[model samples]
Target: MGKNILVLTGSPRQGGNSDMLADAFIKGARAGGHTVAKFATAAKKIGGCRACEACWSKNTACSIQDDFAELEPLLESAATLVLASPLYWFGVSSHLKAAIDKFYAYTRPGCKRPLKIKESLLLICGADEGLGVFTGAIETYKGIVDYMKWQDKGILAVPSVSAKGAIVHTEALKQAEKLGAEI
Candidate 1:
């Protein structure tokens, strides 16, 4: 059976380098017979975790009451998660980080481990080719995977690509497609 893959694209600009990489991964994942659902969080209304600890108390996943309400169930149901973004300040974009931070709700008291997803993948891009450009972001995601007890399916960090559509004609796109197919 095909796995359900949820792709969270964190790039604010549509058709940007990271977004293109996400699209490529989606293409490959679909070609590999996985059901892919993507969400562009740049313009979404998701907010950071309130640390209210009201999630389990209120019997809700999050207390902020924004786009995250809808995303919570999706996150629980997905079999795989793909976090796609452009490296920002050696970290994830604010948009994506907000959504990720809200995951605290699931870890609140009485919730246990909240996510049912079993696997995760990372697709990150950056302008600089210097060492450790993606280290922070990679470590952050790896930590999340460890906390969630999910498998780290893969990480594809493309460097020297900053502008929109910069990945076109590059081997990165092909690699992304191949990664998706392997998934």
Candidate 2:
């Protein structure tokens, strides 16, 4: 059996470590007969979500519209979601930050409702190996999981990988593949 999975690559660099990790995960998932819809934030033109409250008052979705309009369906329909991004200043890339902000539709007054994600994973890569490296990003990821009340599959954080494709260290790539296969 196959599942509909949405993979969001929230990296500023096309071939960055986070992107590679996402690709590895997607590849493993495909090999396991899962259907994946992969999108790169760097490839799309999106803006930060403005607090218009239009999705609640105006409609049942976001008001500050852009490519995100095309994303809502896939996001809502996916059985599993992989939010992978390179750690930028202890958090996700600006690209992903914007995408996440638009999810405000799910947080508006009328639009604010419980999200029912079947399964989810947070894949993050950072350059610093400090003990608290992933703390900030982990908080952000946990916030989403808590908001949606989604099944938290797991979280993978790779440290000391700053350059592109450097996540080959810290066992992140292998973990990503394993996560996909298991998911």
Candidate 3:
């Protein structure tokens, strides 16, 4: 049976490099018989986590309502979670960061809430090829996976691609598809 994959993409620019990579992965994952659902974080109205702990007291997932509320159910049902984002200042874009921060709500002590995702994949695109350009984003994802005890599926970091649709000429697109098929 195929797995349910939830993709959260963070790219303010539509058809940007990171979004292209996400599309490639989604195509491949779908071709491989996996069900894929993608949400464009940059286009959503999600906000930063308030840390009010109201979710714990109210028996809710998140207190500050926004697009993240819409994703809660999908997050719960997905078996594989894919985070695709464009590197900004050697870190993840704020669009994606906001949603990731809300994950803390689910980790409240004795919350009894557990993410259904068992595996995670990271896909990042950046313009600079500098050393450690992708370090922060990768580590952030790693921290989440480790804390959640989810398997780190893999990472695809495509550098030197700044312009939108630049990834169309690169082999990374094909490789991304292949990675999806493998999953």
Report the number of the highest-TM-score candidate.
3
Better of 2 and 3 by lDDT: 3
lDDT of 2 by residue, 70-112 (tens): 7777887788888999888888889988888887777556764
Q: Candidate 3, overall lDDT? A: 0.87
The number of residue pairs in model 3 that clash at the backbone is: 0
On a 0 to 1 TM-score scale, where does candidate 2 land against the true structure? 0.89
Which one wins on lDDT? 3
How accurate locally is residue 151 in candidate 3, as Cα lDDT from 0 to 100? 96
Clash totals in order:
0, 0, 0
Q: lDDT tens digits, residues 55-110, model 1?
A: 75546687667887778767877899999999999988999999999878766667
Pick by lDDT: 1 or 2, better one: 1
Query: Which digits, one per residue and each the tens of the lDDT, describe model 3 over residues 58-163?
Result: 4557877788888888887899999999999877899999988888877777565667889999999899875478988899889999998999989999888888
Task: Indicate the residue-level lDDT of 126 in model 1.
Answer: 88
- Evaluate model 3: give its TM-score: 0.94
The better-scoring model by TM-score among 1 and 2 is 1
Question: What does each candidate score in C-alpha RMSD?
Answer: 1.6, 2.2, 1.4
Candidate 1 Cα misplacement greater than 4 A, ranges: none
Instruction: List TM-scores for all candidates, in order.
Output: 0.94, 0.89, 0.94
Residue 109 deviation, candidate 3, in Å?
Answer: 2.9
